[model samples]
Every structure is written in structure tokens, then in C-alpha cells.
Target: MAREGQESPLLKVEGLAISHGDVPITLPLEIVVERGETIAIVGESGSGKSLTARAIVGILPPGINAKGAVTLDGVPLMRLAERELRTIRGSRVSMLMQDPFTMLNPLMRSGDHIDEMLRDRPEFASRAVRADEVKRRLAEVGIVDEDVARRMPFQLSGGMCQRVALAAALARDPELLIADEPSTALDVTTQAEIIKLLRRIQRERNMAVILITHNLRLAFSTCQRIYVLYAGSMLEVGDAAAVERQPFHPYTLGLLLSEPPVDIRVPRLVAIRGSVPRAADVIDSCGFADRCEWAKQICRAGKPSLAARDASRFTACIRQDEIQGELDALRSATLSATPETPRRGGTAGALVHVDALVKTFAGRRGRPICAIRDVSLHIMAGESVGLVGESGSGKTTIGRCLVGLETPTDGDIRINGIAAADFGAMAKADRDRVRRTIQMIFQDPYSTLNPKHSVGQALREALGASAGAPSPAPQERIASLLAEVGLSAAYATRRPASLSGGERQRVAIARALAVKPAILVCDEPVSALDVSVQAQVLNLFRRLQVEHELSYLFITHDLAVVRQIAERIYVLYLGEIVEEGPTERVISNPQHPYTRRLIESIVRSAIQRAP
Candidate 1:
């Protein structure tokens, strides 16, 4: 509420509901952003976090219907026409998306992207003026190299592309900036840098920002307030520090526990029991009732309204007062619990060993560039080994080499005491037998999964391709495979497009297990998943490893994630193994400066908050 003559909020959303056709995507929600304030809208995929951001910017996809009163600077945006909204966009509000590469034009130079945003402005009237502004904008984002202006999007790294994207968004000096998962795709160090830069720019410009992300750590580190959404409804809204310290909703608590703490190791991440409900599956009752441990019979009675818990906090839970003590106890118990020490020495001989591995690619101007240089590591049978590095640091390349996706330029890869190259010279059956011992799981399961094929069909194909004798009942085998990865038989009937991100990854895992592989090369498998979903997947990996006698070359950029799953850690920097030791030692006492930076980059939301 504004005073009688005072101006309205810089951005105000009231009773906002979004739907596609007859199915509701998000329930009526409210948000208020004052000038120079930062607020986060946090939730898993399909929880309508991104949809809310899109709605606020008047850029919802076709067939999506948004009903609400959205005002910017006292102007009714929802009532405005497309032409009218176009003028307001970039000038009043700008959006920075998750994938900077997707937003940027690959054919155009970085400077041209910024120039287009400033071309219509009176200040940048001439080409020379616009060019100078472009350089200034790029420099503001930490890209000071003048040559970056001429470089195409493909020429720059992921972090550089993100910086350029931010430059274009800030080109118009919008009063409000909506950054939706802006740092999710980058590495830890790059992610921290981008967020720091965004915060600095926001304060310098006195701009209000709506930071939409699934990461509670990121939200708490960068935002002043957090709004937790579950199954399209806002469950909790409070100060970022207050929410991190004590969540009012069970869903918020689950999210906090789901994140692997860098400072303390827990036995297992407390994953939510089930995946988030789809818009069509959402009912009138509490959306989190199925997964909430404290859910009571009355929780399923009807939808709860967001009620004030305190002067600065709001929660949708009806039993907040009754459950506060228990929730706090659980939180304390989970965080301060005995550390799960890495069990070292209970594994068979090395299953996969790479000695003097070197992989080179043809660089620009026909120059040779080494991707993996003298990298040596071994994964013991039934042991999980982590390969941690930033983007372009040969983490994925090594995973690819281990899975036979790429051949080493100059090195020897021995699998089960036999050279990988020698397997090709052996009999066809022997070669096939050795090949089936290693399987790879990619980051984006959708790209690897066949959209046209059902989960059952994909698993069946993998089963048939293996050299082993045919199963007595292929259907039973497929079901068993699905069960191993925490999916039910019914999931077999669903296509990749119909499943959630976590479910699809489960299907991918089932398919990999279909070959009865001894080693699984997991490459950033849970990087993009929500914290709860990532926890579920990581736990599944640990369970499957013991049950099936599997070894993993877990490749990821996140030390926190790797700490939860890996027994040994190898830190890779610029295609070289800079540090290698036990997971606990590497994390606690990093020998390399690069390794220390990676650990420091982790956003420890459980222990820290925004100042």
C-alpha cells in the first residue's frame, strides 16, 4: 500500500494467474518490486517461475493466457497493446534468459547485438556514437578487449556470451531487469562472477531486478527477498536471510536440504519424495501434500491462501505455527548431522585407466589446440571418481574418451586390464563385450533420448543391442531397469517430451543400465535439475552403484555435487589434472590455487546469506 500521494511500486503484480487453454499453469500470485530492490522467484521447472517472468515482461508464448493487473511505474501494462508494450520493453523492462547462446545471434558480432538495442535511442544517434556505446557497454560487463566487438557469439566462451547478453539487456538502462536463470548454464566461478557483476550494475543504476532461479543458494546470495513457488503456487515469501535461516513452508525446507553443502558433508541429501505435479495434474488441494512429511488430512481439503506469518514473512501453509518447532529441529539435525566420510579402499582393481591422455582439436586458422593434455586417472571397479573442472577444461572430453565417444590423440586407455585399442583387433564378439562395459549419460537427456520412442522402446533397443544372451522376458527386464533408477513400469509408456527433467534423466539412466555396463560416464547429469530433483538423481546414482556393482567417472563443474557422490576427486584445469586426492581432502585442503577458487565459488546458502 502506497500513501495517499506517494508513487506506486516500480513493478506491481496483483492476482496473477497464467494458463494454457483450460489448464492453469500458475495460480493467482502477487509480487511487488520497489526501485533498486532485488527479489527472487524460486521454483523447480514447470513450477511457473519462468512463466511468471515471461508474463511480467508481456512475452508469454502463444496459446498462453495471463490474467492479472500488472503495473509498471503506475502504468497498466496488461491493458496496453502489443505496440504500446514494445515501447515499454527495453526502455522500462528487460529480460536476461538462461541460455545466452540461444538469445544471441551466432552470425552477428557481439557489438552489433548491443548496437541494435541502442540504435533507436536519441543519445546513440550516429554509427560512431552507437559503436562507442557498444564498447562502453561491453566494458561495463568486464569484457574490455576491443576485439570482442568483432567476435561472433561462437567465438566467445559461455561466460563471455553471458556478459554480452547482460550488456545488451542493460543497454537501454531499463528501470527494471528480469534475469531468469541467468547463471545456470555457466561454471561455478563464472556463475559467481556474473551474479556479482549483475548486483554491482543493479546498485550502480538504481534498478530493480527480478531474479528467477531454482537455486536457493543463488537466490539467497544475490537477492534481498525470496518467493518460493511449488506446483505453480507461491508457498512462502520473506527476506532472503530469514527464508534461509528458517523456512515457513515444507517445500522451502526441502529445497534447502536438497542442496549439497560445501562446508559440511551429510549422509544423504533429503530429496523430496516425488516430482513436481504438472499443471493438468495439479488439484485444488495443497500441491506439496504428497511429498510433504508433515502433510495432514486437512492439508488436502482445499487450496490455502498466502497468510502473513510475521511482519516480513508470508506462507501458504495452514499449520505453520503448529509445525515451526519440528521444522526447525529437522533443519538443525540435517545441517549439523555427523559428516559422511568418504569410504576409500573397498574396491576391486582399476576398471578404467588412462595414461598420458592427450586430445587435440583443429582450432581457428588450422592451428592445433589440445583439449586434454597428459591427463592420467583411474577408476576402480565399483568406485566413483569425480573429474571436476570449469567449461572448456576437458571434463566432458575425458568422459567421452572413457565411453569410446572420442579417441585419444596420443595415449592408452586400458579397460579391465586390456587396452581399448586392442579390443578392436579382437573378435567381433570380444569387441562388443568390451564396448558394453562402458556407457555414457549426457547432461541434457532430451537431446540423447529419442522423442519419437517411448521409454520402454528405448530400453528395449539397448537391451537387444547388448552381446549377452536374450532375456527370458524382455518386458520384465525393461521394468526392472526402470525400477533400478527409481521409475515405475508406467513410465515406460511415456515419451521424453511428456516427462519432467528428472524423469527423463531417470529414463536415460535406465537405458544405460540396460547394457549391464561396469562403468557409467556421467557428464553433468544433474547440472540443470532443480535442487530437489538433483538430490533425487544423486541418491539414485549411489544406490545403483552398490546394487549393480558400477564404477562412475562423474564429470561435473560443481564440487558440492561431486562431493556427495564421488569417493576420489580429481580437479582438472585447462585440460590438465592440477589436483587429485580423496574427496574430503581435495575439498578441505585444496593444493592448487585453481582448486581453491572452485571451492570458494560454491554458494553456501545453508551457512551464509546476502549482506
Candidate 2:
């Protein structure tokens, strides 16, 4: 831990450059971490935030070459050999990786990993002391049980695994902690718990923290200062509160506008059009010039240097002053850009109906766990219905059951005037009809998409049996599907792993549309997406629903998202529908206590505190 009243900053990074062969990933970056202060390196995906962290920790990939001067308390980390770096890794400085599930050892028990982190410390010399410390750390992070400690990473929920990862990282009491997208995959409430725990632990230990995330909300919630990165370059840096009020850079402002707000009447989110430029595609001009609406000839001719804008604030935009002057006017234009009104569900007959759906899974010791208990809901033709609750409240289960992924213990599911159970039992030709009209879009696109299959191949597989006699041919079908989901036809040959998260999700949506489903069952579709991408995907979903006249059974834990997309909402608690009403009525005046708590859990991106 950093000593209180120590003179110099906890860490310093200067003249940092990272490159893979001739391609530059990051250019001449500079950052300073004061003792016990939290700083956020915020950006969208592919902004080189993780690459910066990897360079600091001396784990740059084999093909990558890093040229930087990174010092921790006057000691140069770049000069250190591998063995020396390893010694300093967990003791003086440590890293908590982005995906906790992948970072943790699936073979080892949770407590074992925590104990191993402190194995080299003299303070934890004995086994008994180490065991006690393990329990204490686990409890500190809200995983307070001997049984929990013994469980493997696969046995724990995403939230619990994240807590275990945190416990392990703090085990050695490192002076600097680098958390890379710490709570990315967790739900809102679990994310809140992790956020509070991180703040408390940082205060208790007086340790400096470097939080790397694409999440602006999480960044504002924790960091004292924010450095916004764009396409491997630092675009803006300022006090969190100051930047929140007035962002100097157009990219930063666009990012803020892209955020999904809890309270706003904006027609649609202001998306920064175009994708993140690849490192190899670097040009002499500003990296964001192509996407920025205010870009002029000068912005497209030369790169801007990081210059002072105001007190303790700097931005790398040549027209920062001009943009700052018209912030309100530009924002008003974005908010005033009207979206096509979502056609509400008229007094039409129900297209998909569920009556007292009950699903029970085999539990420990032969006890049945009721995942769905008398939960009843319906989606009208050309309408959208949402099911929202906490992570384990059976939202996904209900979705799976409705789409025929899971067999309900007892219930009546009617889709397009036909009994869903009977359709499942129908002959081959009849079963194909159900599959073509009622499709499911899963939560994790990475896992749902086949790694071995190209985008075209994945689409062709989905179109099987349904595309009888191949009216459009597989290639034509693939091209049309890609275009429908806002991707270029050239993306057909690209593999899932090569695509960005948003692009992969678009592919997932395309695959679902291959069979031309009339109703979509989307499970937590945008929960794990970056805010900007979430806005884009949400907007895309709205457009697709309108074009296809699609009915939706959207299951998610995000109240804000559901409020925007769903016409009617059902709040699930312990596998039961605790509250049901129109989206506006439920959000404005939530009736049930559980439903109110869920609504309250909707965290705002920015929080203002007393100066």
C-alpha cells in the first residue's frame, strides 16, 4: 500500500508507445497516478486502454513491442527483467483482469486462489493465518461462507466469481491495483455491490487504482479523474465532475450523448457513426475526424496535440474552444433529432400467450427448484413485451421455456394460435414451421455464434430446412441478412472471433432473422454491451421490429432499456410475476415492493456529490 504523506505520485507513465510490427496501437501517452487516488482510463472498445494496462504490467503480447517509461515509486518497471517483474506483480502492484470467469482457474477452489496470492507475503507465513485471511477477504467482498470458498469458479454465479476475483487481487495488499472492466458481465445490483466494495477497499488500504473501462457510468461513479481515449490516442483529461458537466472534445461529448439515460425525452441516442478505426488504419489526421460531425478541413489535415483547455483539464481537439461554445446548441440538436414513433400495440389479439407457466429444475437432494411459478404473460401481434428482474429471478428461464429450449413442468404456451407444446411434438414438417416463426436471440453472442463457422456458414445453418428449395440461395440469403442488420455484405466471410462485440451481436440478430421469425425472444441482449453500442443495437432492434412487424419477448434486468423498448412489462420475483402493467405506468409508479427495488437499482451514469 502507498504510504500516507509520501511526496511523489504513486505511478508515472511517460512517452509511452506501443506497436505491433509497423502498426501503432498507442502513441506517446502520459499518465500520472497520485498516491491513493483513483483514475479512470475510459474509452470505447479498441481504444487501447487494456493495451496500456498490459504494458504497465509487462504482459504485452509476443508480437507487440512497447516503448515506454513506467515507474512505480521511482522504480522503472520497463527496465525490470521478467523474474523481477513477477516478484513485484502481486506484492507491490497487481492486476484484476476483465473477464473474471476466464481469469480464474476453473480447476482450483476459490479459497485456494486467494491463499496463493498471499503465499509470498511474510505476513501470511503460516497456513492458519492464510486461511483466516482468506475468509476475511471473502467476507469483505460479500462472499462470506466456507462453502463459497471451497466452490470452483464454474460453480459460482458471474457476480460471485467477480467478488472472488476481487478478494484474490487484494490478498497481497498491493500498492497499486489495476482493474480492467471489473464488473462488465454482472447485473446492475451485483455491479453496484462490486463498485461499493472497490471504493471501500481502496480507501481502507490507501492504494492507488487504475480503472480501465468503456462504461462511462462506472467511471464517473468511482474515479477522481478521467482520461478519455479514442483510437489509441488520449482525447481528453479532466476532473470527473468537470468533464461530466462540460466535455470539451467532440468525441467525449458524443460518448456522453450515446449513453442510455434514465431520465431524458431524447428521440434517439446520438450515436457516433462509424466503427473504431483499426490501429493499422492510422492516418495523419485526427482518428475521430471521420465520425465527428463538427470536423472541418483542418481536423482532417493534421492531428491535434494535447493542449490545456481550462483549469486542470486538457483536450486533444483543435476546435475544442469552438465546440465548447456550442455545446448546448449541438446537444439540443441531437436530442431534438426525432425517431420514428414506435407503433404501440393496438387492441389486437394476443400472438404469444403463456398461462400459469411453471418450470421446476432438479435441485440438490432431489428437491425441485421452481424456476417459474404460475407466471403468466402474453405478447400481442406486432407488439413488444418485456420480463425484467434480478439475475436469478428466472427471466431467462421463462424466455427459454417460451422458445422451446426448456420444457415447462406445467403451463400452456400458445404461439400464433397453436399450442407450443403440441408444436414441439408435431411431425418434422410441422415442427419446422414453429422453428421458422418463433426464434430466440441469446444473451452472449460470442458463445452463441459458432467459432468454427463463418458468418455466412452460421446463417446457412440457421436457414436449413426452412429455406426449402433455397429460393434465395445461401449466399444471397446471407448477404440480405447482413444488410438487414446494418452490416456490409463483405462481413459474410468474417468469423465471429474477428468481429467486435457489437458486430458479433448484429450477426447474432442476423442469424435469428435467417428463418424469418415473426416473434423474437431476446435474452439480456444489450446488458453486456458498451453504452454506445447498446444505443446502436437498441436502435437497430426498434427498426427491425417495425420493418418486420415483429412481436418481442425481451427478457432483461435493465429497467431503463426495457422502459424504452417494451410497451408492457412484467416484473418477476422468485419465478413469479410480482407486478404487471404498461411500461409507463410501472416505471412512473411501480406498485410492488420488489418491482420498486428493481426500478431503484437502475443506476444513473453520472452522480453529483458535494464539492
- Please give each candidate's TM-score: 0.97, 0.94
Candidate 1: RMSD to truth: 2.0
At residue 324, candidate 2 shows an lDDT of: 71
Misplaced by over 4 Å in model 2 are 1-6, 333-342, 467-477, 606-611
Predicted model with the maximum TM-score: 1
Give per-residue CA lDDT, model 2, range 340-360, as digits (tens): 345677577787889988989
What lDDT is reached at residue 43 by model 1?
A: 89
Per-residue lDDT of 13-90 in model 1, one digit per residue for the tens? 999999998899998889988778999999888799999999988999999999989999889999999999999999
Task: Assess the local accuracy of residue 201 in candidate 2 as a C-alpha lDDT between 0 and 100.
Answer: 92
Give the best candidate by lDDT.
Answer: 1
lDDT of each: 0.88, 0.84
Clashes per candidate, residues 3 or more apart or on different chains: 0, 0
